[model samples]
Target: MPIDWSPLKEIIDQQNRFVLTSHVRPDADALGSELGMALLLRSLGKTVQIINPGATPAHLQFLDPDGEIKSVHDAPALKQAILECDVHIVLDTSAWGQLGEVGKLMQKSTTQKVVIDHHVSSDDLNAIQFKDTSSPATGCLVYDFTQAIDHTPSARAASCLYAAIATDTGWFRFPSTTSKTMRTIANLIDAGANPAELYTLLYEQAAVPRLHLSGIVLQRVATACHGQLAYTYVTQSDFARSKAHPADTENLVNQCMTIAGIRAAFILVQQPNRKYKVSLRSRVDFDVTPIAEQLGGGGHRQASGAMLPGPKDAALKKLIQLFEEELKKQPPAEKNH
Candidate 1:
C-alpha cells in the first residue's frame, strides 16, 4: 500500500513552529527519528523544540551533540512552545500511556497532531498518523517524511537516522531488517554515518556499574514451559546496589535469548513509580506480539513490550503463568526447533 505522506507534508508547509516528542524511556529509533526530523525542520527555517517525557539514555546521547532534547521539567520553556505550537509531532509511539505526561498535554491541545511511528497502532488518537510496521525503525518513516518534502538530510541528520535504524534492527541482525532498510542505511552512511563508531558507542560502551548489574540480571534468568520460555528481571534495588542507571538495563532482554533451545524471552524491569517495564523477544517460530498486546502493549512479531501497573514480583509470577499457557498452545513440533 502506498504511504499517504500528504497530510504530514501539508502540516510542514502550513506550520513553522513544531514540537517533537516520543514515548517515555525511548530507544534509538525514537530519539533518532526525533533528532533527524528536528534537523530537517530547522533546515527549512521551521522552528523546532524537542520535549520528551523522559531523559535520553546515556549511551545514545551522542546523537544529540547540541543537547536539544528536553524533559518537560528541564526546559520550562517547553510549556509555552507546546501550548502555542502550530503542530505537535509524536514519534515512535501511538499509545497514550507510552507518551506519559506528553499524552495528557496532547489531549488538551487543539493544534494539529501528527504521529510518526513503526509499531502496531493500539490506540487511535484521531490525528494524521503515519505508521509502517514494515519499516525496521521509526527513523525510516522520518527519513521518508523528509524525502516527501523534498528536503535532503544533512550529514548530522544522516548519522542520527543511521544510529536509529541500526539499533532498532539489532544492527541488521533482526528478521525485521529489510532491503529498503539496508538501502536507507547505505544512503545514511553515504551522507555521514560512521558504522564503526556507532557500534562502539551503542553496544560496546557501558559503565562499570552496568557490568555489576548485568551479573545480577544474568544469575536471575529463569526458564519455564520446559525451557522453551526464558524470563529475567531487574529490580530497583538491583540498580541501587550496582549504582547503575535505569537505562543501563535497556538491552538485557537480548542476553536472555542467548541460550540455546529458548523460544522466547521476557524481562520485567521495575521502574521508579512501582510499574514494571516488560520487554519480550522471540526466537525461531515464535511471535511475542500477542503476549505483549495481552499485557497492554504492542510492537513487532519478534519484539514487543508492556508496562505493568502492579508490583514486579506479582507481574513476574503472573506473566510466567501466561507464557506457560502460550507455550502449551504452540505446536509440539515447533518447540524443539
Candidate 2:
C-alpha cells in the first residue's frame, strides 16, 4: 500500500524547526534521503539541519559539498538545536543500533519524531513511521514525499537523490528496481540531475589506494559449499598495507558474486576496533536478512550487513558455518551432466 503522506504534510505544516538524520557510516541512500528531505522542508521555508551519527564517508562528501551535514560529535553546539527542533526525522534506517550516538540523543528529545525508511528490520523509536519495503531505496520514499508536497528538488538535491536511488538499486540493475523507480529517476533528471556527471563523480573518482585495496580483496576471494557461496575478507593490516581507508571496502563483496555458480557472497572487513563488518549479498531465491538480523544488523533480502566480534579467523569461521547451514536448506543444483 502507498504511504499516506497527509499526516507527514500536516506535521510539516505545523512544524518550524527540523533536524534530519540517518544511520552511521552513512551511504548514498542515507545521505541522499537526508539531503532530499532537507531540501523539501527548506522549500517550504522551514528551518532544517542535517546531522548524523558519523561524519559523511570521504567518498560521499561530494553529495554535501557545503559540509552542511555534520557529525553529532563534531557539532557540540547543535545538541540544543537538535533537542529543541519541532520535529526530528530519521531517514533510511529504523534500527536504533544503526543510528549510533545520534540515536542516544534522540531518545531524550521530547519533540515529535518521524521515521521514513524502506528496510525490513525496525525498532520502536517512538515515532510515526512511513515505510515501504517495496521501495528500492529510501531516496524513493523521499521522492514520494516531494510529490505529496508537489515540490521539485533543486539540481543539487536532485543529484544527491539520483545518486542515492542509483547506487542502492545497483544503478537500476538490482531486482528491487521497478518501473516506478525509473519514473522517479526520470523526474529527478527533469528536475536538473545529470546522471553521467553524478556517475563519474561517484564511481570514476576512486583514489589509487581504493584500487589497491580492491586488488587485495579480490585476491582473497574463495568459494565454498560446492561453489554456491563465495567469500572474502579485508584485514586491518590490508588497509595499512594498501594505504586505503575503510570506506574503500565498499562494493568489494559484489566482486565475489562475479564467480560462476556462486549463489551467495560475503566480505568481512575488519574495523579499527577489531570487529568485522560483514556485508552479505545473494541472487534470487536466497535471503541474507535472516543472517544479518541474527547478528543484530539488517537490510534488504539481497543485501544485508552485520558486525561480528572478531579474531578475524573466528569471525570467518562463524560466517562460513552460517552460510553453509543456510545453503543446506536450499534444494541442490542439478548436475550439468
Candidate 3:
C-alpha cells in the first residue's frame, strides 16, 4: 500500500520524544538521513535521539558536528532513550533485520512507527512506510517530507541530506539521478549546504591506509565476459596488511566500472567467519538487482549488493558463474544483417 503521512504527522505533533535509527554498517545515505530527520524533529520541539547498531564511520563524523548520535553498544543508555520516545523513525532501511538484533526492541514497542526509505524492497516493512524507490536517494524523500510539513530544515539537516543524495547517486553520476535531483541539491545548497567542503570531506579526506588499500584492490582487478564484467576480491589478510577498516572499502566497486569496456563491476570483500560482502555496479542498461536477489539480497538495478556465507574462493567462483549466467540472459547485441 502507498503511504499516507497525515496520520504520521498527527502522531508527531502529539509526541514529545522521538527515536531515529538506520541500518547497521550505515553508509552516508543511512547516517545522513537519520541525523537529518533527527535534527528536523528536534527543531519542532520534539526530543529526538539518533541511534544505530554500530559507530559512525570516521569519514562521516562531519555529519554529527555536535556528536549526538548514540550507538547500541551502549544498549543500557540507548534503551533508556528509546523508552522515553513516543515515536520511532527508521530511516534508509525498511526491514528491522537491517537494524541488527537491537532493533527487535523497537519493533516490539507500541510507539508510533514511521519509516522513511527509498529502497524498493522496503515497502513490505511494518510502519507508516514512506518509500519512493523512484527517488534518487532517501535523502530526497526526506527533504520533501520535511518541506511537506512546513518544517524549516536546519543547516545540519540540509547538509546531511545533501551528503545522502550526493553519495547514493554517485555524485549525481548515476542514471537514477535526474534534473529533479539536481534541483533538490540546489535547494539544499540554498538551505546552507557547503558542497566544496562536503566534497573534500567525503573523498579527499581519506587516510593513507585507505589510499594504499585502493591501490591493492585495483592491482588485483579481474575482468570477464570479454571485459563487459569485472570483479575484485579483498581477503581478510589484505585488510590486516594495509591496516584498512572495512568501511574503507566503501565506493571501491565504482573503481572497477571506470574501465571503458566494463559495463558491470563487482567487489567481494571477505568478512569474519569466511563470509563475503558483495557489491555490484552497473552502467547503462544492465540491471544487477536480479543478480543480488538470486543470492538472497536486494537493491537497485544499477547498484545492488549481497552477502555470501562461505570461503572467499568458493564464493568468488559461485559469483563468477552467476555473472556468466546473467550475461548470457542479456539479448545479443543487434548485428547489422
Candidate 4:
C-alpha cells in the first residue's frame, strides 16, 4: 500500500523539536530537501535541527539559511540534539545503511523516525516511510509535504527546493524529469525562487580548480568496446595538483557520457586506505543499477555508484574487465535509430 502522509500533519503539529538529516555525500537534492523541510517546519513554530554526517560541499553552502546545519564530525552537540528531538526526518536517503553507523543511533533514539525520499530501493527504516520513486526529486516530496500543512513556502524554502529539483533533473535534461517537475519548478519560481541566482550559485560560481581537475580527468579518459563505454580515474596526485576536494568531482562521470558515441561512462576516485569510489552513468537504455548492486551499492538504472575495497589501479582494472564481460552479452548495436 502507498504511504499516506495525512497523519504526518498531526505528528508535525504536536512536535516541538524536529531533527532533519540526509544521505552521506549528499547531492543538492538531499541537502536542499532537508533544508527546505527544516525551514518550513520552523515556520510552523517547530524547533528544527538539521544534521548530516558529512560536511557540506562549498558549492552547496548557500542552501543553509543561518548556517544551522551541524556536521556530525565537528559538533558533539548533534548527539544530544538527536536524542532530545521529538521527531527525526531523513531525506533523500533510502536506507538506514545509507546513514552508515549513524543509523544505529537513530534506531536507539526515542524520537519518532520518519523518512521522506524518492529513491526506488530504500530499506524503509523509519516508523513512517514516505517514498515515491516516481517523484523527480525529494524536494518535490517536501513541497507536497509543505502544501499538506497549508504553509506557503518561504523564499529560502523555494530556493532550496528549486536547487534540489534543478540539479537532480540535470537542469531538466534527465529522463526522470516530467511535466510535474516543470509545474513544481514554476510554482517554486512564483513563490520567489530566483532561477538566475540558483544557476549562478550551482554552475556559474564553480571554482577554477574544479575545471582544471575536470580537464585533467578528461585528458586521461579511456574508451573500450568500440567507444561504447568510457572511464576516467582520479588519483591523490590529481587532487594535490588541482587543490580540489572529492566534492568537486561530483559530476565528472557525466562528462564522459557527453561524448556522442559513448553509451556509458565510469569514474573511479582513489580514496585513502587503498579504497576506490566508482560512479557510473548510462545514456541509452542500459541499466547501471545491476553493476552498482554487484558492488554492494544501489541507485537509479541510468546512474548509479559504488565503492570498491581495494587499490585504485587494481579496482579500475577489475571494473574495466567487468564492463567488457557485460558488453559481450549485449546484442550488436543497431545502425539506425
Candidate 5:
C-alpha cells in the first residue's frame, strides 16, 4: 500500500525543531535516511539535528564529511535537544531496543514521534508510521517523502540516499531490488549521485586492519546442519589480534553465504560486554526474521540480527540448534548433498 505522506507533510508544516535518529551501529540506510531527511527539513526552513546512539563506522565517515551526525554519548547536549525538539523522526529501524539510549528519551518525551522505516519487525512507537515492508530500503521511502512534497534533494543528499538504497539492495543484486528501486536510483543519479565514486568510498576504501579481520573471520567459517548452514565467529581476541574495530565485521556473514549449497549463514561477533551480535543472512525463500525475533531481534526476511549472551560455545550451540530446526522444515531437495 502506498503511504499517504500528506500527514507527515502537515506535521512538518506544524513543527519547527526536529531531531532525527536511527538504530545503534547504523548502516548506510540508517545514516543516509537521516541525512536525506535533515536536508529536506532544512530546505523547508525547519531546524534539524541528526543524532544517533552510536558513532558512524570509520568506513562510512565519507557520507557525512561535514560531521553533522552526532552521537548522543559523545555529546551531552543532544539529550537537551531531544527534549526540546518539537518532533522526533526515527529512520531505518523501528525497534526501541535498537535505539539504545535514544529510545529511553523517546519514551519519556511527550512530544510527537514519527517513524519512517522499511523493516518488517517493529514495536508500537505511538508515532505516525510511514512504513512499507515491500520497499527495498528506507532510502526509497525518504525519496518518496521528497516526491510527496515535490522537493528535490541536494546533490549530497542524493549521494547519501543513493548509498542507502544501493548498500541495502546489495548493489541492486538483492531480491528486494525492483524496477521501482532502479527508477529511484536513476532519479538520485539525475539529482547528482555518483554511483562509481560512492561504491569506491564504501567498498574499495577498506583498511588493512579490516582485511586482517576478514581473513581471521573467514578462516573460521564452518558448515553444519547437513552442510546447509554456514557460520563463523569473531571474538574480542580476534579483534585484538587483527587490530580491527567491530565495524570491520560488517558484511562478513554474507561472505559465508558465497559457499555453494549453503542455504543460510550467520556470524557472531562478540561485543565489548561479551554478548554476541548475531548477523543472519539467508536466501529469499528462507526467512531469517523468525530466528532473529526468537532471540529478541528483528529485521528483513533475508537479513536479520539478534544479540545473544555468550560464553561463546553456549551461544554457538544454541544458534546451531535453531538453524537445525529451521532447516529441517525445508524439503529434502533443499538440503545440501
Candidate 6:
C-alpha cells in the first residue's frame, strides 16, 4: 500500500525554517527519522533544527557525530527556533505525552506543525499529519519523502535512514517488516550504508549495565496460559543495583518470546515517578497494540506499551489478568502454532 505524499510534500515546499523532533526517550527510529528528514530538508536549502526532549542514548550517539540532537538543556534555544521556524516536523510518534516539553511548546506556538509518523496515534493533533500505520518505520516514510522531492540523500542521510528502519523493524525480524521495507533498506545500503558497522554499533557496543539489567528482568519471567504469555518486570531496585538507565533495557522484553509457547511478552519497568512503564511484544499470534491502547497507549501489533499507575506487583498482576482476558476473546485460528 502506497502512502499519498502530496500533502506532506506541499507542506514541506511551503516551509523554510523547520524544527524536527520526536517522542521522549528517543529510540533509534525516533532519532533516526528526525536526523534523516533534517538531512533531506537541509539538502533542499531549508533551515532545520532537530530538538528532542531527551538526550540520545549512548548506544545511538554514533548517528550524530557532531552532537546535532538538542536536549532539555537547549530548551531556551528551541524556544527561539520555535518562534522563528515556519513548521515543526514531529517524527516517529504522534502522542503529545510522548513528546514531553516539546509537545507543549508546539501546542503553544503559533507556527504550523506536521506529524510524520507511523504509530497508532494517541491523540488528534489537529495539525497536518502524514501517519501511516503500515509503514515499518518513519524512516521509510522519510525515504519516500526524499524520493517524492526528487532528491537522493547523501551517505549520511542514508545511514540515518538505515538505522531508523533497522531498529523499528527489529533488524527486519518483526512482522511489521514488509517487502517494500526491505527494498527501501536496500536503497539506503546502495546509497552507502554499512550494515556490519551499523549492527556492531547498534547491537554489540552495549554497556555492562544493560546485560546486568537483562539478567535481573529475565530472572523474574513467569509464564501463564499454558506458557503462551510470558511476563517480567524491573523495579527501581533493579536499576539501582545495575546502574542502568531506562534506555539500556531496550529489546529486553522481546527475550520472553524466545521461549517456545510464549506468544506474548511483557516488560514492566518501574519509573522514577512510581509509574510502571510497560513494554509489550507479541510473537506470531497476539496483537498487543490494542492491549496497550486500553491501558492508555498505542503502537504496532507486535510491539506496544503504556504507563500504569499503582504499585509494581499490583499493576503487573492486573495487566496479566487483562492479558488473559484479551487472549480468551481472540479467535482460535490466531493462536501461535
lDDT of 2 by residue, 1-337 (tens): 9999999999998989999999998999999999988988888999999989989988789998899999988868777778788999999988899988888888997889999999877496899999998899999999998988888899888998999999999899988899999999999999999999989988899789999999988988999888899999999899999999887887788888988888999999888888889999998878888889988998877889999998888988988888888888765567588
User: How many angstroms is residue 43 displaced in model 2 relative to the true structure, after the best TM-score fit?
Assistant: 1.6
Q: Per-residue lDDT of 1-337 in model 1, one digit per residue for the tens?
A: 4479997777888899999999998888899999999999898889999999888877678888778899876766777777888998999988888887777877888988888988786796667889887887998888887778777789889988998889888789887898988888888888888899888887787789999999999899988878888889988899999999887887788898888889899998988887999999887577788889898898877789899877777898888887887777764463353
Computed on alpha carbons, the lDDT of every model, listed in order, comes to 0.85, 0.90, 0.83, 0.84, 0.92, 0.85
Model 4, 1-337: lDDT tens digits are 3447887887887779988888888889999998899888888888988888678876688787467877776667787788778998999986777775456678888679888988866377756888888887999999988776677899888999999999988899878888978988999999999999899988887788999999899899889878889999998889999998887898799888888788789999988665888998886557777788888987877788999976777887788787777667664467786
Highest-lDDT candidate: 5
- Candidate 6 on 1-337: residue-level lDDT in tens? 5777898888777879998989888988998889999988888888999988888877788899899898845658776786678998889888888888778878888788788888886686657878888888999999998888788889999999999999888899877898989888888999999899899988898789989999888888899876778988888899999998887777778788899867788988889998999999986567888789889998777789899997987998888888888888763463366
Candidate 5 on 157-212: residue-level lDDT in tens? 99999999999998999878999999999999999999999999988977899999
> What TM-scores do the predictions have?
0.81, 0.85, 0.84, 0.85, 0.83, 0.82
TM-score of 5: 0.83
Clashes of 5: 0
Tell me the spans in candidate 3 whose CA falls farther than 4 Å from its real position.
Answer: 1-4, 122-125, 235-246, 268-279, 287-300, 303-321, 332-337
Per-residue lDDT of model 3, residues 1-337, tens digit only: 4346687778888888888888898889998888788788878888888888888877788888777887877669787677567888888878767887548777666777888888756345568878877888889888887877887677778999999999999899877899989988998999989999999988898789998899899899999887888999898888999999888897689889889878789999998667899999887668888899999998877789999987877888888888888877874466587
Report the poorest 10 consecutive residues by lDDT, candidate 1: 328-337
For residue 324, give model 6's deviation from the true position in Å.
4.3
Angstrom error of the Cα, residue 327, model 3: value is 1.0
